[model samples]
Target: MGLLWGITLLWAFSFSLIGVYLAGQVDAYLAVASRMALALLVFLPFWRPLPWRQALVLMATGAIEIGIMYLFLYKSYQYLTVAELLLFTIFTPLYVSLFADLFARRWPKHLWAPALLAVAGAAVIRWTELSEDYWKGFALIQAANACFAFGQVWYRHQSKSTSLTHRARFAWFFLGALLVTALASALLADWQKLPVTPVQQGVLLWLGVVASGLGYLGWSYGSTLVSAQQLAVMNNMLIPAGIVVNVVIWQGQVDWLRLGLGSVCMAGALWLCRRQSS
Candidate 1:
């Protein structure tokens, strides 16, 4: 559980860096395709190959989490600003919890407070990112968030009985599924626009190997240690709350009021998480 939270924070922050770096470079389809290919290569050796069941799950998971969700998000950047993208992302958890309830049939003991606090924090984060055109990005971002959040929980469920050794049972499924999704993306998108710069290459490397691979491993293993409700509270890391603060700090614009607001948001998240854990 501790490791899951720790890695969650790191991956959340790293995703922000990746998102900012990818700004205006390419569409989400190509971006996800390129990144997913690399991720499959990295994980290919883990398991010999995948069974039909695992392969299907991986493909389905990739379609929702990467293909449909991310591709739409990429298209969103074309229409909306970053601020709007972040705001709509806050709503994703609500969708995830709904999926969890329908599938898992319950939340943690008392999750409404932290859940509500997390929603408020999302509102504050959205407020910070608001723009006239950013609202246009809301639809895609919201879809991406819901897909990702639900996919995470579903993926966890799929791997529930598997061992967590280096020989991960899910690796082949994840890789094969990603490969198919990437291939479909290639058929649908302009593949020539890929292999752009060293920055994109490096970002894809990090996203595939570290963020998607290791971060997911952490999330999967961590979920085993924590309750679904706890996992939901921990999912707050998706918002990149800390990275926003880091950006503000880097700019040398010290606004105590905004900082205090962010701090309150963090505190609420923390308090709610603690309550869930207890």
Candidate 2:
């Protein structure tokens, strides 16, 4: 849970940074490819052999979760405001809860209430008038959300190895992501849009090394420790956290009333889940 919380803060900054610094300035495919490549480099040294089956599963997880998901996310930014993108992701908790239950073949009914509450909290925080591109951006973000939710649940349940084993072989996950992103960048990227400025390059390096590499590792491992309900609720935490980052760093306008209300709702959701579990 602590790991998840820590990564949540780190990823909140990532959300703001990408939206402000990289989304429109850099080629989406190139950004994704570069990030994955850099992350791959970080883990490559620790790589070890795993059974063919486990290796394949982890690779597939990475490809879908980060590789394909980033494609949807980065492209959606062209059609959506950062706030809209964040708001649309409110559905992710529901997706996570549903996928976790489906994979387990048993419904933990208690999970649903808290998950729904978390979604409501996120919705409250970002509610606004809809633009013409709402449906398109919504669809793209939903696809990304579903893929991310599925990957987290699948990896948390399917990977039965000890922590040491997971670390030793985790590079394969990024390799799989790299294959997808690299292929996309090669085929679809606008070469003219590559990062040229020092800030862009530095941001890419930070995102790739610390955010993608360390953040994903922490998040994946953290998922193994918490209940699916807790993980589901935690997904919504990113919304307020990201908004706070934007407010602090980017001087983005924020509605204090809504922020306070949403925070209360999310806290209530967390408390409810914890009480139920206890």
Candidate 3:
């Protein structure tokens, strides 16, 4: 849990950095590719060939989990503010719980009520001012959430069956993610919008080396140390941490009433899920 909390703190500033420094300013694919490449480098020294089957599974998980997830996540900043982005991510825990159950082939009948509550929470945010751009961003976030949730569930299960230490096999994960992002950058990145400013370059370096490389390794290892219920709760912890970082550090304004109400609804969902799981 300490490791997870530390990674959460490390990641708290990630959304704001991307929103302020990379998103819309730098090409999303290029930024994602750069981050993945640098992150991959961190684990490259530990690389050893896993069984082909294990390698493929880990690779596939990385592609969906971080690679494609980042694509959606980075693109989201074009439409959503840091506050709105953080608020919408409140649904992630619910997705995590749902996906875990699905992979286990068990349906928890009680999950539906909390799921609806979570959706209501999202609806409560800016419901009066819905627009195409807002909905697009929301959809992109949900997609990223699903990818991340699925990957967490997958890795937690997959890691248990593997014999290699986390450091020994984790590079395969980043290698998989790198392939996806690198291909996307080659095909779709905007060459004209590369990172130019020192701040942009520095942010990318920090995000790649520390926040992503180390943070994800810590998170994946920590996920193996805790209960699914605990993991679900920890996933949501990033919300308040991120919102506070965005608000206090960046002076990002949030619609307090809406944020409060939405947060209550989302919190209720988490509580209900926790109660059900327990």
Candidate 4:
């Protein structure tokens, strides 16, 4: 549990920082493609070759899980600030909770108020992004967040199956993710022109190996270890950490009033999550 928490914290920090990197780097999809390629290269040897059957599943998961998510993320980063990007994330847990209720036949109890609070808080945080450009970015990031929620739940379901070791499955998934993201990027992005930088390469490498691969694997493992409700509760902590990290590391502005509102949102969300868990 502690390791999982650490991994998640690292994941959160890494993702927040990647915005600055992506802002300066090559095309977003291309960056994703490159990172996936690098991660695949690193993970394949450790996990061994895969059978064609499992590879297909990996490919599908990768396309939705990585390909589309990265595409829009990059697109969103183009217009949205890191804080704005994260503000949209407040909707993901709410979406997942609602979806789980519809499909699984039981909604998270006592989540209504907290979810609403979170939404309001997020709106306040993102109030500055009411411009047309920010609105578009907001929509894109929301889409990515929705996809990420789906991916986590779907991958959790897969974790329960006996078809393959988690490590191996993760590796195959990375390989498929690379291929899918690469093709998607090629189709969607202009390869003729791209930002070139040494730091960009370094950031991409870190994102691939440390952030996506290990961070995801750890988060998945934690989800499997802990109840979804508990994980959901803890997930709110990421907001404060994100805000702080942004203010300190990125030299971003701090709106104390918004931060206070975010705290209330997190408190409500946590309370609801705990209640749901019990």
Candidate 5:
């Protein structure tokens, strides 16, 4: 949980940094590829070969979680306002909860209420009127959300059975992500939009090394430490945390009433999950 919370705070600033510094200036595929490559470098030194099947599974999880998710997510930003993107992400907790159940081959009726509550909380913070033609953006975000949720659920379940520590085998995960993102960059990245400024370069370094590398390491491992309900609820914690960072550091506008109410709702969801675990 500490690792999870720490990474959440670390990533809270990432949204603003990307929106302010990299969104239009840098090619999204290139940024994704750069981040994955840097992250792979971080873990590569610690890599130990796993069973062929385990290695493939981790790679597949990485492909779905970060590679495909980032592809869908960055592309959707073109069609949706940042607010709309945030709003649509509220569904992620629901997806996480549902996917966990699907993977486990049984429904944990106990988890659903808190997952739905967390979604409601995030919606309160982020929901706004959608653009008339928002369906494409919505679909893209949902696909991203579903992929991310499924990946987390899959990894958590699989990690329980693996003898290798996460660090020993984690490089394979980023290698898989790099393969997808590198291919996408080769095919689709806008050459003219590559980062040219010192600020942009620095931001990418921070995002790649610290955010993508350490952040995902922490999040993936932390997901294995908690109940599925807790993990699902925790996914929504990023919404309020990111909003607060945007509001405080970036001077982004937010409705105080919604922020407060939504935060309370999120807190309640976490509390409910704690009670269930106890």
Candidate 6:
């Protein structure tokens, strides 16, 4: 729980930073590749050999979750506002709950209500006029969300021996992500649009090392400590947290009434989940 909360705060600025600094100026594929490469490097020193099967699984998880997920996320910034992007991610909790139930081969039965409530709350937050690009961006973000949710649940449930710690094994995860992103960048990115400004380079470094590296480590570890229901509810925590960061740093205008009301609903949903667990 502490890990989740800490990462929530750390990640609060990530959306705004990407939207403001990297989205339009940097080639999305290149950005993704660079970020993953740096993160891979961060974990490489601690890397240990794992079974071929386990290594492959972690690699696939990273490719889908971080590699492809970032592909959708970065492209969506061209079409949607940061607020809309965050709002669309409200459905992630539902995806998380569904995937967890599927992977477990039995429904928890207690997760549905809270997950639905969280979705409803998120809908309320963005119930205003939308641009024509809404549906496209919405679909893209949903794909990213589903992949991310699946990865988190899958990693959380994996059985491992107590030999090497998770940190020691995480390099394979980022290595897989790097392969996907690097390939994508090589094939799709505009070489002419690489980061040139010092600020751009610095932001990329920060995102790769701090956000992708440490943030993922904390988030994945945190998922193991909480119930699936709690994890589902906590997935929505980023919406409000990101919004607060956007408003404070970028001075983005937000609907306070809607934000307050939606936050109440989400809070209520989280409370319900906690009560059920108790």
Evaluated with TM-score, which candidate comes out highest? 5
Return the top candidate by lDDT.
Answer: 5
Choose 3 or 5, whichever is better by TM-score: 5
Per residue, candidate 1 scores C-alpha lDDT tens digits across 1-278 of: 68766776667556555656664565456667666666666666775655777666666875676557766677787777655666566665566566767676765346455655666765654466356665557777877788777777777776665554533544654665466566667677765566478887788778877776776666766766765556665666555445554565444233455445655774676676777567
What's the lDDT for all of these models?
A: 0.64, 0.88, 0.81, 0.68, 0.91, 0.86
For all candidates, what are the clash counts?
1, 0, 0, 0, 0, 0
Whichever of 1 and 2 has more TM-score, that candidate is 2
Model 3 worst lDDT window (10 residues): 123-132
Residue pairs in clash, model 2: none
Candidate 2 residue-wise lDDT, 167-263, digit = tens: 6556988988999999989899999998999999999999999999998999998998888889999998988898898899899889989998998
Candidate 5 lDDT trough over 10 residues, lowest sum: 161-170
For model 5, residues 133-219, the per-residue Cα lDDT tens digits are 889999999999999999999989888787788886679999999999999999998899989999999999999999999899899
Could you tell which candidate, 3 or 6, scores higher by lDDT? Answer: 6
Query: Which residue pairs clash within candidate 4?
Result: none
TM-score of 5: 0.98
Better of 2 and 5 by TM-score: 5
- The model with the greater lDDT, 3 or 4, is 3
lDDT of 4 at 50: 60
On lDDT, the stronger of 2 and 6 is 2
Poorest stretch of ten by lDDT in candidate 6: 157-166
lDDT, candidate 6, 103-179, per-residue tens? 88995699888998888887787665667758888889989999899989888877333355778767988998999
lDDT of 4 by residue, 103-191 (tens): 45675675455556656666565455444568888789888876766666666666676567667777777776787787887688767
Candidates' RMSD to native: 3.4, 1.5, 3.1, 3.1, 1.0, 1.8
Q: Sort by TM-score, best first: what order?
A: 5, 2, 6, 3, 4, 1
Model 6's alpha-carbon lDDT is 0.86
